[model samples]
Target: MSSNTFKQAAEAARSKTSAMNKQSSEAVSAVKNDFLHTPVMRAALPFINGGISGMVATIVIQPIDMIKVRLQLAGEGGTTGPRPSPLSVTKDIIAQGKALDLYTGLSAGLLRQAVYTTARLGFFDTFLKGLSARAKAKGRDVTFVERASAGLAAGGIAAFIGNPADLALIRMQSDGLKPVAERKNYKSVIDALSSIVKSEGVTALWSGATPTVARAMALNVGQLAFFSEAKAQLKAHTQWSPLSQTLTASAIAGFFASFLSLPFDFVKTRLQKQHRGPDGKLPYRSMTDCFIKVAKQEGLTRFYRGFGTYYMRIAPHAMVTLIVVDYLGWLTQ
Candidate 1:
């Protein structure tokens, strides 16, 4: 061929290659859109599942959570009486108030789970989709790490937003000594929130923010990373439907995440309880002090107080939350 003809041929080949590359990129984009879209269509399932599961799990584990909080809040050997083990705490409640005590704060716990879990799951998915879209617009692929980072951010933000409800839930669960008159004063969630803010000040609502943030960060990391990985692995090995896969993966993720963050949770619960000294300020003063004091008085094992309950609550909570969220997204689509 002539030199001009050869140059034209080379240019044609280059143009064809560019067109093929564009097509491949579009195909990848289409696949990602499908993946994201599937979840959105079934979004209602996740909300329902998460709400129900979280409420049930919280009720089942509230007593152990109560014990955990009590152990955490107890001053250095300043208990009302002998300390009870996790198992004994339940027995004590049963002996004293029957099943009612164990289910203390059931309403508060249900409200919290309903709000926080829905927000966390909903916002996390929304944020992830936005981030993925942004990445795609920049001609980039969204990595698992990116997804996890988004999840962490979403969790932290959600925790901060829902911190007030969380405080109320904790207070209701652990307020064993407060009189019936005082307890009955706050009728609704808003009433309880208003009462706390008025009596304890707005800052009281965020008493355990440090540990709450830490827990949220850890939880998101575990859920996003582990849940994603588990789903992928399950899909590879089993022919389960999307719902089944989502539920199984979420349960595994929730269990491990809860286990990992149990210590921080223990600390957070301890610090938030009414530990005021004579000056009407918190006795522990800070998260560090709370940790140090608990360690000194109750030993390191105490830091993991109610760990079994933590696992039991978290595993099902996470599983249900994920499954419900995923299913909801599916239904919507």
Candidate 2:
């Protein structure tokens, strides 16, 4: 009786384990097949890829962005003198505290990228895909003009949606450049948002919306258009590897992006930080006034204040983002 009972129990357990394993394997295979084959899965891939790549790029580049903002804000002291170079700004920042101080507004930067970059890149890809499909149906291919238009529209919309985060970012970055007593001392992205809302009201969050949106449109047009065309050109005319192609395209994209958007970016930062004087008058009435005054008073070069640092930040981020996006898409598909 004991031998028969023990043998039967062992046999039952083995059968149950084998059946469970088979079911699990089938489920895994089904999931893998659907992810590889489904249209819906493919469609959502761009958004996921773009969002993740953007956040990753933002993390890598936030310090340079913070330094760029500080360089621009450090100009307040330079009005009667020559503007400080990026190296001087970096040294000054390091002198103020630890090297990591250069990443003071990192949280805001991440939030901005999560909202702005994600939306802009995702929407551009989505729009591009739609246009490509339609064009293909007509026995045509998507044009560069079409790509630029998609990028511009996507960027403008995303910038508007991300304005609050962008304003918070500028404030947080510039706040550290202020006198200790005058600093708002934002604790984090949420703290900055809440403080701005409490002190200034909802509309204040969008104070520089015009310039912000303009900068984004310019940036998208430069980055997206240049990258696409440059990559295609490299592919068609040369035998560059994928890595070489991405790096070259990204550098070209970054150059144009920094050049076209720096002016608007400068204005946007100033406008976002502008406040009503004790006399109830704001420094600049609008974007045009800000641009004019900056050019006249600070000189035209103020618009390109930190071009080297900006290029460093923009180029690496663009390359990382594009490469990651491509890699993720291939892995997923």
Task: Name the top lDDT candidate.
Answer: 2
Q: Candidate 1 versus the native: TM-score? A: 0.73
Error of 2 at 80 (Å): 2.8
Each model's TM-score, in the order given? 0.73, 0.89
On the 0 to 100 scale, the lDDT of residue 77 in model 1 is 40
- Where does the lowest 10-residue lDDT sum fall in candidate 1? 71-80
Give the Cα error of residue 203 in candidate 1, in Å: 2.5
Best by the TM-score measure: 2
Candidate 1: residue 126 Cα off by (Å): 1.4
lDDT of 1 by residue, 9-103 (tens): 99999999999999999999888767656755445444455556556656666655666565555444442466556676667667767676666
| Global local distance difference test of model 2 | 0.87
